[model samples]
Target: GAGVSQTPSNKVTEKGKYVELRCDPISGHTALYWYRQSLGQGPEFLIYFQGTGAADDSGLPNDRFFAVRPEGSVSTLKIQRTERGDSAVYLCASSKDPSGANVLTFGAGSRLTVL
Candidate 1:
């Protein structure tokens, strides 16, 4: 039972820099997801991985955002050319199934600030 966890808790960076956020999912979870939440808004799906392959990546805003779950466990969200608009909380969640309806357990998230 270790639940999902994110690293750095907070990250501050300048525009045009690169940043990486890490996530550790619960043991035995086969489905992992990444989401972004801006102030006063609900979390928006970014990407999801079922096992070691990305099942859905439609929510990734642009080429600047990418993620990977190579071992079907831990994942990392990488942002290239960070911009002020990218400032938000990067949340990671995991579930037993890849179905969208599955209830996901979430991490506190890594808050990113681009100045």
Candidate 2:
């Protein structure tokens, strides 16, 4: 796809379960990002990967949340010990340029519901 793509548009899990969300970015994009949005809040940045390396991960809430982009194109976000509060829409975005306000193309997002 020319834009970012996220799998499992909806997910339902019980508390304490583990889950994984996937994202595939546009071809040739060097910068990728993950964000999470709760019901009433705006998306909050979770991580940013440049190529296959995570350039920024300060936004991750805890060690239980992790993301990886081993090939620079496909990324996987892993969450352990899910909680009801973790329910949200996980958004993925990509940009060709990593600097200077370059526009990012965002995926429709994967909705997670923890019960």
Candidate 3:
């Protein structure tokens, strides 16, 4: 794909249920990032993967949230024990610059609704 792609554009899950959001970054992009956006708020960085390793995951709010970029192109964000507070839009982005300074191309995001 020419741009970043995310799956399950909208998801509604009951509280305490689990959810997974998928992201397919643009071809050849090595830097992938996951962010969360609450209503009326800017995206908050959740994690960043440089290639297949997690370069940073400081923004993950708790142990219930985890993400992986195994092949360096696709990534998945897993949420366990989902809570109402977890309802938000999950955004995925990819940057092509090796220096990691290039502008990021972001996916439309997966909106999660926890009831």
Candidate 3 residue lDDT tens string, 1-115: 8999999999999999999999999999999999999999999999999999999999999999999988888999999999999999999999998667969999999999999
- 8 Cα displacement, candidate 3 (Å): 0.6
Clashing residue pairs in candidate 1, if any?
none
Q: The CA-based lDDT of model 1 is what?
A: 0.94
| lDDT (Cα, tens digit) per residue for candidate 1, span 45-65 | 999899999989999999999
Worst 10 residues of 1 by lDDT: 94-103
Best candidate according to lDDT: 3
| Count of backbone collisions in candidate 2 | 0
Which is the winner by lDDT between candidate 2 and candidate 3? 3
lDDT of each: 0.94, 0.94, 0.95
Per-candidate clashes, comma-separated: 0, 0, 0
Q: Which regions of candidate 3 are displaced past 4 Å?
A: none
Candidate 3 TM-score to native: 0.98
